[model samples]
Target: MTIHVIDTGFFKLDGGAMFGVVPKSIWNKQNPADENNLCTWAMRCLLIEDGDRLILIDTGMGDKQDAKFFSYYDPHGDATLQSSIANAGFQPADITDVILTHLHFDHVGGAVHFSSDGSQLLPTFPNATYWSNEAHWDWAVNPNPREKASFLKENIYPIKESRQLKFISGDSPFANIDFIMVDGHTEQMMLPVIHYQDKKIIYAADLLPSSFHIPIPWVMSYDMRPLQSMTEKTNVLQNAVNEGHILFFEHDPIYQAALVEQTEKGIRIKERAALIEFL
Candidate 1:
């Protein structure tokens, strides 16, 4: 088995919202904000190759939204979903599975694209089975007002319309790949736990979005339940440290992956390195 880091691109978000109630004085030191108080973040995805199956975890925000919508986030980067996949020696058709961590636009937007002349939308991966959980699927389709803006129908409906959507019920069919269900960020967000190359590497998705977010208290304000986020983070971090798991960060601006150690104060980053080193 092999793993590749697919950097879809970077986008901006309000630093305050990303860091929750954590004071700007604290988080600002690590992730410095722009004049508008918005911080740039990477939309890094993961591509896993196990024999013939090329599984992609989390598609970044696609380029289907209008200029007005794009102005809000301002996604700008040299890499794109198609470009990154080709860089990894694969195409959209090569992806056998597309695991959506959740239905958030930034994560699942690249899963679908607009058709020619912009009349209809289509799945980006024409031959892949898009994976999402039933609980989260239901929650996203009928979203709460707080999260409704993030869950766009354009990014979702195409897969089911194409008859390739698969629900990860009971347990996932993919071997050595397990999920950690976290509801704090969004209802039933599935974080991939892959037993790869004799080591357990966690695709930390939004649960631990960036290396700066490793601290238990640095929860995102967007989370539906902040306290649940703290508890989930603590448990995951404890297990990560105890079991010696390398964390694969999705939105970290700089660090690709990191090792954490149990410090006197709490869990902290031990070393920051590329995913290839861990592999």
Candidate 2:
């Protein structure tokens, strides 16, 4: 199996919301914030080449929102979903599967895009089967008050309308890949566990957004249930330390991946480096 880091780009989000109750003095040292108190984050996606399947995990937020919408987040950077895929020697038509961890705009926005003529919205990978769980699908489509803003209709409805969406349950449909369901971040958020040779790489998703979130208490305020998030983190961190799992971060601006160990001060990052170094 081969893996490529598809960097769609970087965007700004308020540091307080990302770090929950963690104080500015604490997390600011980790990720310095701008004058507006927003911190930059990477919308990093993963592309896997195994057998004939070209699977993309999570599509970074697409550039379809109007200027007013984009002004709030300030999305910036050169690399896009299409360019990164092409850099990996593939095209949108070549992708066989798109595994969405969740339907939050930042994660699923790139899955669909405007048609060339701008008359219709369509699946970005017209030939690929988009994978999402039924539970999360229902949650996103009929979003609750707290998460409604994150579940934008333009980023989601087009996939189902195009008849390219499929739901996975119980077991994963691909070889050497499995799913772990966690409800803390959102209902049934699917984390893909990729078995590569001797190492197991867990697509951390929002469950552990970055290496800075390894500590049990650094839960994101964006989460619906912060306490449950802490519990989920403890369990995942324990398994990562016990089995030597490599966490593939999705939102970290600097580090791409890391390994954790049970330290004197609970589970902490053992090493932080590019994904290629761990491989």
Candidate 3:
């Protein structure tokens, strides 16, 4: 099995929301914000090539939204989903499965795209079976007022409408990988832990967005249930440390993967490394 890091570019969001309850004075030292008070973050996606299946996890905020909508997030950077896939010597048509951890615009936006004529939005990976659990589907489609803005209907719906939406077996979402269900960040947010080439790698989807988020209290305020998130963080961290799992970070700007060590300071990141190192 081979894993590829797909760079979907970067976008800006308020640092305060990203790091809940954590003082800006501290987080700024980690990822500093711009003059407008928005901190830049990478929308890093992952593509897993396992035998005949080519599975992509999270699509990043897509480019179909209007300029006015984009002005708020300030999406920047040269990396794009298409280019990243091409670099891996594949095309959108070749993608067999798209596993969306959640329906947040940044994570699933790249799932859909505008038509060349700008008349309609369509699935970005037209040939792939898009995966989302039944619970998250309900939560996102009928989002709470707080999260409604993040779950854009245009980015979703089109996948189902295209007749490609599939539920990861309610029995178990993970086929070869283990599905770690985390709810503190969102309802039933699924993280995939794959046993690849002698190492176990967990796609640390927003549960641990960056290496800076390693500390226990550093949970994001945007989380619906911060306390639950804290508990989840502890569990995942301890397991990662004990099992020697490599965490595949989705939103970290510079670091793609890292391993955790139970440090004196309650589960600190051991090393920041690239994804290719594991392959």
How well is each residue in 167-203 modelled by candidate 3, as lDDT tens digits?
8755654457778888999999999888886888889
In candidate 3 the C-alpha lDDT for residue 270 amounts to: 84
Candidate 3 local lDDT, residue 231: 96
Per-model RMSD to reference: 0.8, 0.6, 1.2
Q: What residue pairs are clashing in model 2?
A: none
Residues 92-208 of candidate 2: C-alpha lDDT, one tens digit per residue: 999999999999999999998999899999999989999999999999999999999999999999999999999998778999899889999999999999999999999999999
> In terms of TM-score, how similar is model 1 to the real structure?
0.99
Off by over 4 Å in 1: none
Regions of candidate 3 where Cα sits further than 4 Å from its true position: 171-175
Cα lDDT over the full model 3: 0.89
Model 1 lDDT-worst window of ten = 169-178
lDDT (Cα atoms) of all candidates against the true structure: 0.93, 0.96, 0.89
Superposing every Cα of model 1 onto the true structure, what RMSD results?
Answer: 0.8
Q: Is candidate 2 or candidate 3 better by TM-score?
A: 2
- Which candidate do you rate higher for TM-score, 1 or 2? 2
92-188: candidate 1 lDDT, tens digit per residue: 9899999999999999999999888898899999989999999999999999998999999999988889999999988778997999999999999
On lDDT, the leading prediction is 2
Instruction: Assess the local accuracy of residue 272 in candidate 1 as a C-alpha lDDT between 0 and 100.
Output: 87
Cα deviation of 49 in candidate 2 (Å)? 0.3
